[model samples]
Target: MARDGLAAHYQGEDIAERILSALRAAQGADARVTAEVLAPLDHFHGRGLAATTEMAARLDPQADDRILDIGSGIGGPARWLAERFGCHVTGLDLMPSFCRAAEALNAAVGLSARVRILQGSALDLPFPAASFDHAYSQNVLMNIADKARFFTEAFRVLKPGGLFAVSCVGAGPGGEPFYPVPWASTPAESFLATPEETRRLVLDAGFDLVRFEDRTEAMLPARRRMLEEVERDGLPALGWHVFMGAERSLELVANTVRSDLAGRLTTLELLARRPG
Candidate 1:
């Protein structure tokens, strides 16, 4: 029963309220994003962002480089990259509201001059060839059905010798199916590719796979710790209000653990070169 629609309910005040309430509940009274404008849920996302930044830094782009963030959500990762690496960032996402909020948050953080978001899909980015020095994404590939097209677009925007680093949830060796993210009924409309399949797709799309790491093992222990912490404190008491009211959140976590234990879902990172 995976829901195939674009989780687009996250528009306008109603969706904003739900997100804010969830943030307030999980973050206690002092979340970073203001209650008026829903910001990217950073507590749950920062660790991954940090990991991506570390990986991208290893690429060693020049200080004045421009980077693209595919499927950037609320611009947290983009801002993180800008602040940490002194790079100008442009974020693209299919959600207009997300783009607006991302811009607003960038302005609020006084990063508007360096970080920005545009309403665009990964399938068709509005950019000229060789526009970016580096491109990176996190947790986005699982939702994109067309891996070939996704990599094609990523390759299209990047300059020669540019680096592309991505982290995503993918099917394990068995090639399992999808379920909705926690608290939502049904599964995601998209399919998660196997690690080998993903690597082949990237290579096919003309990227030189510099490094590919299957971190499914690392994610297992991390999720177990998160579950233990959440169980000790109630959902509201825990710092995960972002997914609040989605009773299925716990279910999703359980399923993720099950999949990881069974080697079905993996957290993998891929580093590729656009070929100078």
Candidate 2:
């Protein structure tokens, strides 16, 4: 998909306002805005905040570290990291709406000083070489067609020995995934690579692999439960559906689980380091 087309896929009007309204409704109108309070609603990927928590553990950020959050939707993980680790986080994404929402939410949670939001592409990071101590991306690779450039740019921006933790949905052996998944509405917007290709791209980018896991089997049970819950009671009040639209979001999430169960989708978690 073209850059504009890709941006359009995730675009929404009054995104920040809508999310804030939902938050206030879920909690009390005067409830204090904090990262933990926003946890259930802000993380826009599969498994939500739990996935971000796991990725942070792998990155092992220090209080003084400068971290990059590639494809940070609404700055959930970035704010969470900044609050928990006292690290500085720069969140980059392709959608202008998302960047605006991220910045607004950062201020809402009193994390504007610690978290910065930028609207940009993963394939072309707007930074100097060796700029950050570590980097991470979650569920963002499926939209990027040039996987090589994505990995290469990440490698370029990280300081030597900096860790990069990435978790994404890869192509499974069982044909193609069902359409209308969370990341894409159709195959035109989705660009999934096999596990072998993903590993090769990371290695080719000069990153020494620290850990790589095919988490498909390990995560299937949880995914099934999520699907069942959605089917049983519909989406919760405070969730990604607030911005993505409840009905469309339901279709997207259901197809994701269907694809996974049918072996058309696979999840991967990778930890790599720029060699010293």
Candidate 3:
């Protein structure tokens, strides 16, 4: 049911081809393709690539690590990590279109050898036990109704000493968030857990929590700056709006920021290690 909701929310056709056309237009048809050029279009969460940068710092990936990207959309961060750290990345997305698009983008960036894309559910990750050295997901948990299963699957796929990092939107202290947020339209499609419940689920999943922070305060300045940038420059020619729809994308971003400020929504950054 949750998967169906997410698929419905993110469903699109020919996402890869459209993004390729965007890239070609932006950088010229024959120009070199890189994750740097694609970041704006493929970074589909709050604060865009900046959030990925901070997550990467926390992840501290090594050159040869086998990293799993949960809910990797079009392989942006997967390619980025593979490019920046020379690591092998396998990305899983619930939407087949996203997985297909990820493959096409990986091919475009010449990271096909390092980044693999698969279509699967986070609740039941298709990989075998101890399949990954490290793993992470960004802004992908809110759509999920089963937080415990998500963490358990993450734990199962990771090596004993593997670490799983995540950045998620948590339910805030106030009442419900506004409708038409990024993850869902009405309350039926969204499943936001409070910070306390989020932590407890991770612990129950057998991961020793290394760090957990409500990054709402930290994200405020960046969030505001982004709104200003949008007001000043409007939407960029190249962005995820191609898939998410321009007006809807803009509204969702602005609404997310508004909810954050209103204490209706908060972001959480977490790091947990499967006990060695």
Which of 1 and 2 is the better model by lDDT? Answer: 2
What residue runs in model 3 are displaced by over 4 Å at the alpha carbon? none
**Superposition TM-score, candidate 1 onto the true structure:** 0.81
| Candidate 1: stretches off by over 4 Å | 1-4, 8-40, 43-46, 173-178, 182-185, 235-240, 243-248
**Candidate 2 per-residue C-alpha lDDT over 1-276 given as tens digits, one digit per residue, 9 for 90 to 100:** 366667767878888788889988888899778887888888998889888998898898999799999999888899999999999999999888899989998988889999999998898899999999999999999998999999999999999999999999999999899988999877888999988899999999999999999999988999899899999999988888899889999999999999999999999999999998
Q: How many residue pairs in model 1 have overlapping backbones?
A: 8
Local error of candidate 3 at residue 212 (angstroms): 1.3
Q: What residue pairs clash in candidate 1, if any at all?
A: 1-186, 1-187, 2-186, 2-187, 180-187, 183-246, 183-248, 183-249
Top TM-score hit: 2
TM-score, one value per model:
0.81, 0.98, 0.94
How are the candidates ranked when ordered by TM-score, highest leading? 2, 3, 1
Estimate the TM-score for candidate 2.
0.98
Error of 1 at 71 (Å): 0.4
Taking the tens digit of each residue's C-alpha lDDT, what string does model 1 give over 30-65?
Answer: 766531223235322324445755766666656668
| Model 2 residue 195 distance off true place after TM-score fit, in angstroms | 1.3
* CA-only RMSD, every prediction: 4.1, 1.0, 1.7
* Per-residue lDDT value at 32 in model 1: 66
